[model samples]
Target chain A: MNFLSFGHYHHDMCLVLHRSLQLDNNSMLSFTLAMRDGQAFDTVLSRAKSMGLAVREGRLLASAKPVARAFSIQDPDRHWIEIILEN
Target chain B: MSNSAFIPPNVLPPLLQKFAPLLKRKWFRELVLLWPTLTRRRFSNKTEDYGVFKPSLVGHFGQLAVYVQDIARSRIWYQKVAGLTHSRTSDPEPHPSKPGWTLRACYMSAKEHDECLVLLEERDPSGKMSVPSGMSFFHFALEVEGNRKEDVFAFAAQQKRDGFHLNYGPVQHNSEPPDGDGETGGNVACYLYDPDWHNVEFCGAMDTIENYRARYGDKKGSDRN
Candidate 1:
């Protein structure tokens, strides 16, 4: 299984922090999205709740460069998504 | 000299330690001035990282990826609908979680569009395809540059005629809400489902999270400065 890959976004921009995970032995390629579209981070969380999306465990992600508040969620398709905002 | 001074320096002094490394760096500005002689001297071909933050890492919209149960079927569907051709597959990346194995990946580009879509799949020993379920990625948009959004809609309509699953319309998505006044500062978009359930979208706009949020969320305005 070699076709699983992550879609890299536009090159001219930036993400405050990022990380990835491999959930499948051969066919699955997944990433925990700690950053989002230009919307504010907390607003994303609140909107997610309003949409009835499940928010999983949350913890402070510590990095020397930037401090981030993060949480996880599972979509209808069972894909786990992590939302993060740098504080 | 005292015992401390007797320890003759092999490395630079503490104050020089940091700048010494910078002076020896390949991307260092002074090195370019020295390169005329340095290259002739054949000091070293190795290049240095100018900064830890690199725009090249995220440079360019590389690929719009989606999940597929059967790659061959997906390929045929894309070819028929969007006139996308199989550009190439890259060497499998080392599986992040699995040991002694690699992940398979390929890039397919449209003749009309500069960007490509990444198809990720896996095959068993018996040659049967295994697809992972539940992709978290909402949708990816293709920029309309020289190609007109009207042309995109026409092509999408034709795809429907050609028997592809045209899930949604060549309609203007509302910028503020799920359904609102149709003054779309957002994107003129159409949605399609591949052979698998991967939701693919074509938008007549450039790459922006504002576009993504407009389609997927309730927010009308962008918070980014």
Candidate 2:
């Protein structure tokens, strides 16, 4: 199993690891986690782009933690996996 | 530079042992063998002395940094209720075009190896305000004076009266832990909001402070009670 499979919400980092996928030896996978705060999403996306990962698929879904907002993102790997958050 | 002594140690396990034979494959063996050792030397030069690590970074590994829009209000609330003390307060980094917005903030510490929290706010005209949400970054609880359930409960009550209420037990008290752990005994907690409305809590097991400390040394654990 891949070590990164543990999808957890780190309070300090303010990030939720929504999903994980193990890739073949020569491939890479990248997806975005939705922000609970609507305002922080754009800032997070900009950071992701600077890392050379592209947006492959994304959508908005509602959440109910402390504040509620939708998650959206894309996978940059060849498998083209998707993650969705729904209220 | 001509000596064979520069070769890296052959530390591969049985499964990787096959790769060692290739080191003697003429051009491949001589060229690739030195690469790992060269990389090791460069890495060693840049490595930090683990024993000499800064104390601030050592204990503050997992500490939270909460950026608030209002610095003064957040500082007062954390000091008065959360039992955290300021380590330092500083201004924000300046901008190039404008005169620059000042960052007014303070650092607060907790016990054990937890990181010191750096509460910050930008003092620029464009500075944004904080919106409290249960889902937002939660405020961390400080270790309280006693470990008993009553002490935490009482402190929670006092906070409520002092106008610094936090989210603790539900009004119905349904949140109390079910009893009878050999160590835990029971659980009680209190919760409140900071100036920014971030959720903060103080909780205790029905045991001595020393007992709890001995059992969980400033690390997260499954709720025993």
Residues A1-87 of candidate 2: C-alpha lDDT, one tens digit per residue: 001111121111122221232322111111223343333445555555677666433321111122132233344323222222222
Best by DockQ: 1
Instruction: Report residue B71 deviation for candidate 1 (angstroms).
Output: 1.9
Candidate 1 runs further than 4 Å off: A1-87, B1-59, B89-96, B100-102, B112-115, B123-129, B144-147, B175-185, B205-225
Q: Which one wins on lDDT?
A: 1
TM-score of each: 0.44, 0.39
What Cα-based lDDT does every candidate model obtain? Answer: 0.45, 0.39
For model 1 the local lDDT of residue A18 reads 12
Per-prediction DockQ comes to: 0.03, 0.02
Q: Where does model 2 sit among the CAPRI classes?
A: incorrect
Residues B63-165, model 2: lDDT tens digits: 3445454556667777788767766665555421125444444666665422245565544557743232223222344445675666776787788687753
